[model samples]
Target: MIKVMDRLLLFVYSLAVGAASVFAIVMAAGGFDADWLKNAVDDIIGEDALVQTLVIAIGVVLLLLSLRIFIVSFKRSGGQAPSINQRTEHGDIRISVDTVENLALKAASRTRGVKDLKARVRAADSGLQIMIRAFVDGDTPIPALSEEMQKTVSELVQETTGIPVSEVSVYIANVTQAPTTYKSRVE
Candidate 1:
């Protein structure tokens, strides 16, 4: 729904810009003899093609800046990578919530002592939020396990997806399976 709205807005905005640019070009062409227009613009700005080029350049720069901000804001503190925002404008491309969640899950699974990982992501007012569940071995220390898991998973996801992980819930579902003894194996 949000994505649709953004597209609609962007389309409308582009249409408006195009209309305005055409009007400006026509006016400039007609008023080439006007002293004010001539003084305000040079050959670069006076030419219709040049005006169009400048508009495009400005649009590209603004789009890139918006993307940069989105990436920076979506990331967790501590120098983590930016989180991709659902409404983030990146060179006309948008990142979905599902993609961010999937990346988080994959990153969590890569951490040591992490057996299984499940991540859920939802859109927030300003950005996106995440919930993480990690299944770890029973022998792993609670404090150390939580800390390391948080760091590894958070870093990986943030770096990969550029979305800040708002909340990470670590649930140690069960301990790792014990190795089979020789006698047990024989039996």
Candidate 2:
């Protein structure tokens, strides 16, 4: 719903800017000499109190709406990763998403087949969701390796932080080829 509204607002703003640009260009190119354009401008500025008042009101509303749209677009995606909250006897405890991500990376690195790993932690309804993207050796069995990575990352995060992990999704991004070694020949 918010996305739809944002797109609509952007469309409206684009249309307004386009129209204003055309209007300025035409006027600068002697469009006012045309009878229709001259008559329309005269009518708007002709000292009829109601027409002037209506134009001013519309302009003010458009200005306000444009300002609002600009501000909303500027601050659209300023969201931080969610933190884990725990209740302790003395006080509350909070664990940052970074910590969970580090734990996931550590666990994945320990897995045999994983060559490179990247982990992202996000909050979920049950607790946290860990997403791991990994590159492994080409000979590794992807399905089994991914499952092991998922289990390892989930268990390690839960055990280390004492926070429940709803899911650990593993994505095998690539399979790396072993580097070939060249033998030196002395003649």
Candidate 3:
């Protein structure tokens, strides 16, 4: 609702400003009789109470719209990448979450039975919560594979980035099916 109002207000404001600019330009170029236009405007305002109120209201709305635009123009997204902020005696360090996810994927892929792996990292209250969803190859026990993945991801992320990982969750999504290639003797 508010967005619609903002767009509508902007459209109306732009139209009014454009029309006023064109009118002024024409008058200054002597394409219009400036005195007659001025008198017409004066008469419209002077002869009607409703017209005077409407003009004042429009002026107030335009002033408000100008201020709104001016204030919003200064706001910025800062164009900064999302990263984990760290401070030490030397300086500040930032490690992007994407790097962490990549690290997790790399670590999980090292497990023998893990395939089609996807990793997600979320900032937790204490540290980071990592989730790994993988398709298993059925070459190893699920419990052992899950354990190894969790440990590897947690340890690698923590060691490489110096960030504590609060938890690592692994979900074995499915088992992989290998395609068989069979060739028959020539007839």
1 or 2, greater by TM-score: 2
RMSD of 3: 7.1
Q: How would you encode candidate 2's per-residue C-alpha lDDT over 73-110 as one tens digit per residue? A: 68858576567888889999889888889999999998
Q: Answer with 2 or 3, whichever has the higher lDDT.
A: 3
lDDT of 3 by residue, 56-145 (tens): 898898899988766656766366867888889999999988999999999999999787999889887799899999999898999999
- Which residues of candidate 2, in runs, are more than 4 Å off? 1-11, 32-34, 47-54, 66-81, 87-92, 139-144
* Residue 5 of model 1, lDDT score: 57
**Per-model CA lDDT versus the true structure:** 0.66, 0.86, 0.89
Candidate 3 clashes between residue pairs 3 or more apart in a chain or in different chains: none
Q: How accurate is candidate 2 locally (lDDT)?
A: 0.86
Please name the candidate that would achieve the greatest TM-score relative to the true structure: 2
- Give a tens-digit lDDT track for model 1, residues 1-187: 7457556656655676688699799886894558756665664456679776887787785576556556655766574344443445554434665677777777667666777777777656644566777767667676787777667766776677665655665666666676676754554
Ranking by lDDT: 3, 2, 1
Off by over 4 Å in 1: 1-90, 184-187
